[model samples]
Target: MKIKSLSLAIISATALLSGAVQAYETGDIIVRGGLASVNPDVDSGNIYAGGVEQADQRVDVNNDTQMGLSLTYMVQDNIGIELLAATPFSHNLQGKGGLAGLNDFAEVKHLPPTLTVQYYPMDNSSAFQPYVGVGLNYTIFFSEKFINGADATFGSLELDDSLGLAAQVGFDYEIAENWSLNAAVWYMDIDTTGTFKNANGTGDYKIDVSLDPWVYMAGVAYRF
Candidate 1:
């Protein structure tokens, strides 16, 4: 009888340890929140005047940060569908090249919604899980303001919306049975055409700007 009791105790102990190591599982819902930064690597073209190129005139944009949220639904132990969202980000625009020393020439607000399919390489029993993802990003721009207290210098600012491909690599390290720390980086393709009329009334000027941004996030995740 004592031998049988000892055997039962060993089985119970093994089961407890096994359960402790399980991080994420099928049908689990994970939510993460923290700060996210968007750093644009802008490739801007020269300004055009009524379809004619104007040399030495270009646009430059600066970065912004806001609250970031991520939601994940586990389809399998190793696979998940994730959505990334954030508050509207505001970016400051400036001039480059011959247009240098131009600060806060314009400002705009945008929101990017991204959907991704992530593959976690580790099993459910591992506390550290790294993932790679492929996704799509759509950005909408609004509330464009041409500052410098000289609204008459430039007419309405128009920035075209963007739809592009995105890729990400990230990791989650389990700190508790239902909590983890997450760090992620994403690269998105964002291109836009900005057009505004010159106050001097030299027709409308257009610029083809590629704002391919790298996004970084670090936060705590809760699994439910």
Candidate 2:
């Protein structure tokens, strides 16, 4: 009877330890929240009027930071599907190249929601987990308006929505039974055409801008 009681005690202790350092398994859900920034690597095209492209006129875009959030569901031992979300990011539009003197031309808001299939290479029991993911990103641009000097010269403005591929790399360090620290970076391919109407009684003009941005995020995560 004493030997049986000792075995029971040992088993109970092992179970308690397992609970204290939780392992991510199938059906686990992780929710993370933190700060995220989007920095645009802009490649601006010449402004076009009618069928003619301008000589050297171009535009510039500035970066912004906002609260970011994400949700992940573990489908397999080392595979998870994650969705990244955030508050709308606002940026200032400026003139570049030939139009450098006309800076801060406009402001706009956008949201990028990305879905990725993440692969965790570290063992499930490991406290430090590193992951890589590839997925789709849908960026929606809105509230585009002309401002500063360009506002008086341009009547109205609109930007196109973008759908592109997104790639990510991140890690999570387990802090307790149900919480961890997380930091991630993503590269998104975003291309769009911005159209503007001239206030001087001319037709609509267009410019193709590739605002492919690198996104960085860091925060805390909780598992359920």
Candidate 3:
């Protein structure tokens, strides 16, 4: 009975040691998928119709959540190149301050694809990997349309695309040899100017929107 007990103990220790030696090596490719939430820290400009400014009438955006995917290729034991992608996110536009009483003005859809170089601080063999990244984000805006009869009043509306800087901090915890759970938070700098024509008259409306957003993602990752 004593010999059997000793064998079990040795087996458990060997399993632990094997897991500890598992490491992220050069030429490794990692794929991750999960939910990503984007919340804009907005700074909107007052509305101007026909070049006439409307006092305190600003534009704001709501938050959205969508499926997020990321692909990473290790260049070294501690460095990697990552590309982040996701499905389109839709946001409802709102009027704020003096225009706060107005109904929803419009809705817009966008896709932000980011590329970054990440630095992992922990040892490659460690199960818990924490990383920091900095790179660029290009946001493409589409399917912008007015709602609640605003289309009839505002005519056609258009929002410009944006290219900006992005940064993030994240961590990964290995649950098995090739599987890890990950969580990350990123800050993005996004800005755009929008224009619309007033159908009721000959005036053109304009607004400068700054949608600096914080994005959060939580999901599982698999190494290849």
Candidate 4:
């Protein structure tokens, strides 16, 4: 009876060691997509001399909803690289008080493509996976329009092309062997300047706006 028990213990230890070796040899790729609401903390500066309360001009921007896709390639147990893609986000701008009747409203569309390097400290665990990322983003603006009342007309709004920094914190919960749910928050520090012009005697004006936005997203990811 004693000899039988010792043989069973040796077999169990060998099986556990084999499982650990198999775990170290596995690689995973994950694809995820989600939606985010982008809220911009906007500040505008007017370049025209004697500009009417440019510093205090109340600017209105519509809240933007954006969809994004990310592809991650895990190079090791706890490190990966991700590439992110998204559609263009459009926003409307309106002047509230003194210039309300002038060329008051305009629309601008921007596309930001980002790339990140991520580190996962808990990748080897079964229940929880947390990650942090730092990256760079580039923004391009297009499709601009101006509307102000009866004298409303079309013009060019100048937005300086910008490069910015991005940061994110996120976590995932494994629900099954090949599936997980994810939630994340990201932030970008973007600075931009634009010039608004109108053909109607309203004169050409410039605005310097800062769009530092926060993004919140949740989605499911599939691993292979």
TM-score, every prediction: 0.91, 0.91, 0.91, 0.78
List model 3 lDDT by residue over 82-103, tens digit each. 9999999999999899978765
Q: Model 1: per-residue lDDT, tens digit, 42-155?
A: 999999988899898898899999999999999999999999999999998888987787766888999999999999989888888899999999999999878886466887
lDDT (0 to 1) per candidate: 0.90, 0.92, 0.92, 0.71
On residues 1-224, what C-alpha lDDT tens digit does candidate 4 reach at each position? Answer: 99999999999998775444321113678777788667777665654523554555555566688887777888887887777767778888776556555444777788877678888876364446788999987878888766554225536667787789998888777776657788877787778877665665456666667787786778877677
User: Where is model 4 poorest over a 10-residue stretch in terms of lDDT?
Assistant: 17-26
Counted clashes in each candidate structure:
0, 0, 0, 0
Q: Give the candidate number with the greatest lDDT.
A: 2
lDDT computed for candidate 4 = 0.71
Q: List the lowest-lDDT window of 10 residues for candidate 2.
A: 15-24
Off by over 4 Å in 2: 1-18
Clashing residue pairs in candidate 1 (N, C-alpha, C atoms within 3 angstroms) = none
How far in Å is the alpha carbon of 66 misplaced in model 4? 2.7
Query: What stretches of model 3 exceed 4 Å from their correct place?
Result: 1-16, 19-21
